[model samples]
Target: MLLVPAAHAQGPAPALPTAKPRPPAPAQPAADPAYEAARAAFEALPEAQRRAIQDSLVWTGDYNAVTAGTFGRRTYEGIVGWQRRQGVEPTGILTVRDRPALDAAGEAVRKSLRFTVQADPASGAVIGVPEKLLARKSPLPRGTRWQSTDGRVTLDTTSSPPGGTDLDALFERATAVTPERKVTYKVRKPDFLVVTGETPTGRFYIRHAAGADGIRGFTMSYDKTLTAEVDRLVIAVANSFSPFPNAAPAPEATPSATLSPGGARPGAGAPAPFAPPPLPGSVARPVATGLALGNGRVLTAAAALETCPSPLIGGAPARLTLRDPTGALALLEGGQHAQGAQPPAIRVEAPASGEALVVLGAEAKGAAVAPGTAGAGSVFAPLQPGAGGAPVLDRSGRLVGLVARFPATPRLIAGVMPPTSHALVPAGTIAAFLAQAGVAPGELAPAHPQGASLGAAAAPVLGSVVAISCGR
Candidate 1:
């Protein structure tokens, strides 16, 4: 105790050790105005065009994220990466000059792969496949499957009804650490799940979505040796996947053959009965018109068949045989037709501008006709949604062209946008397409007497036009 008294005096001056202060966080880099401007320019493009650019980047091995067609940090980084590879300043902007080269490069790869977008007939899900790569296609019990020639790359699409396994179970099974699989990443959401991992000899990507129609998803696996070529493709395929295409119509709203005045053959009996209304979140069926090309062939707009897994022509199943490279027309084979129906004659010479024309179509209500005028290369008419592929006839009842469904391009008038108009595929183009398909169109006969009314001119071809309905 006495010794502690002397130490207490010295101990009072002693202070506890002090903790070191933390260093300040690193500063963020300043925003680049040029890069922002570049992004703005890219964002201004249409969604389809944006996705195309991203696809080009992926093909060039500069992008590895989803091709969502939306602007974000990942997209920006991809653009910058592409710019750097071109040996130019990395402004992250694609100039008009730069785009052509990039698109050409991408197109080459697509051509080699025979890339195409298709919907699974079983699940009604849309996805992109490299047709040349996956030369073999087979049916699954509840889905569809595709594989490469050597079976190194495989794709499988599957679905389950409402009372089937839940998402939790699926997630657990997909991510399970089996001896043959090693999951590297996984994500789960209320209505979807995505898992990526490596197999014993390859890599795999799985995606699934839940909805009123139940669960729908796909799995893609590719050999490890081809990772350089397939890694980016996985992102593209995923982006294009649509578990439930929004364009699909409700069962009840599907247009029946009877809806078209000309759809019923001479004696096809009563129209098919309609189903109950579709469940919540269903859309109207996409409808279009088609022209009867004799011998079980039909011609229609290709756009209407974009997401259709099973296309119906006048309530009969049909197969698409050929498509116009210009994306304006498609030829369907094996469609049913009335007996002794004569296809309309085709006029090779285009109509002069301002010439009166008649547009014939099988509309929702019935067979209908509208007056039009020939422009430089298109027929100008007040066309409706299902008017595509309607026959455009001359005063002599000769086929001049077919209505084409083009996206409504907005135009500025006095700083205001107005409704857009529709155009048609000219006779010359249609003739060339027919020739390529080895179908000789009927030659035009002697001209009819002058001054024939539009209604009278269209009468001969009314029954030849039929409505086209597609189911997803």
Candidate 2:
């Protein structure tokens, strides 16, 4: 009664007392000029080189973001952190002197981990794995499983068909608390789910995403003691995950010499060729196309050979016989084919700008073709990743050039998109290279009409193309 009387006397207590005003946040320190200069320098580097640097940072555990080549606040902070750890001024930039040491440190860790990207045939999923850490691999009911040597870490990849357990149901099961499992963090979205918590053995993390192919996901568990190491690895694995990569072609039976029309069969004394074993566990092997030069010889891009000194040509091991000084061409002396398979006619004349052309390559569906137009020294065409070393033929099927490089991945240039084009090695250069290697340039075929179908003109040469794969 006394309190009510006091409030009434004060006319509603002068309204509720207002909250005190918060002090203005301290002015943010100005950005360091050195940091700005370093960022500018990094951004000026080639995209591929920039990505390599980011990859190094990831291995060193200073970065947890995707190796996208694009720099951002996270990348700057990571650089600064690494600098501090190296007992250098925190410049937030990698100088020429700093790069060597950084690379060495990162390389050591990478070697120890033996990280590799693997394509899982069972679940049709591609992911990166620390092969050295997870040496034990086993088949699961729905997919594949990998475990560490001491059984302290484990990874499982699973897939479900459409109309199977929906995302909601899976999330429920993943997050449900059991007597031995404690749920800590959970998130559910329209097309994905994530659950993390503790288990009797250690901690666990699960991620699943819905796609047209249904659901694909992975679960990882490791001992608490490995949190620091495992956490960085988790970021890399997640960034490298591809639920559905391009479908690889099924293994095919070796073609007989008769398949090459107008080609001479090998002599009876010729050694029998054999296909290399399927890449260990279907790893993400580097692949390219090669042109057969008859007499057990082949020509392909030198870059592909750099990764795998002994590459497989048409699934058989090949020996490098010669490499062009420019590093754009390579010759292999093994992987025996039909003795006198007619090599595609090499036209010394380069294709004129805007000339219509056809590109031929060895693909999942045997020989594939794509229409293209010749530029000043390149070709504009929609090409796939392994298209390098493919043959570019004129409208009349005459060899015009070879695809030296694929189009670079798209990048923004001052907020503008750059033109997409692939590099082409002219037929003149190829002919000279062939002469230097002592290989005969085959005779030209009768020219087809300009209006003739490019695909028809390329038919004869398709048989000469072979798929080249290199493995770690």
Top of the candidates by lDDT? 2
> Local error of candidate 2 at 115, Å?
1.3
What's the CA RMSD for each of the models?
Answer: 31.3, 26.7
Model 1 misplaced stretches (Cα beyond 4 Å):
1-27, 246-472
Clash totals in order? 0, 0
lDDT by residue (1-472, candidate 2, tens digit) is 0000010111221222232332343454687787788789888888787767877887888876556676656578778889999999888878888889888987888778898889887776787889999999999977899999999989899988665756556755886778999965443333454566787768887877655466777888889888778877776676567665653322342332111221111121111101011122232333677788876667876654544555775455665666676768877655555234567778787788988777775543244455577898887764444667888888777888888855333332211112246788888888878877667877656656554454356657767777676633
Q: What would the per-residue lDDT of candidate 1 be over residues 272-371, giving only the tens digit for each residue?
A: 1111111122233236778877666678767555545566765666667677767678877544553234577888788889887777755443354555
Per-candidate TM equals: 0.46, 0.44
Candidate 2 overall lDDT versus native? 0.64
Which candidate leads in TM-score? Answer: 1
Task: Evaluate residue 254 in candidate 1 and report its C-alpha lDDT on the 0 to 100 scale.
Answer: 20
Q: Judge candidate 1 at residue 20 and give its lDDT.
A: 30
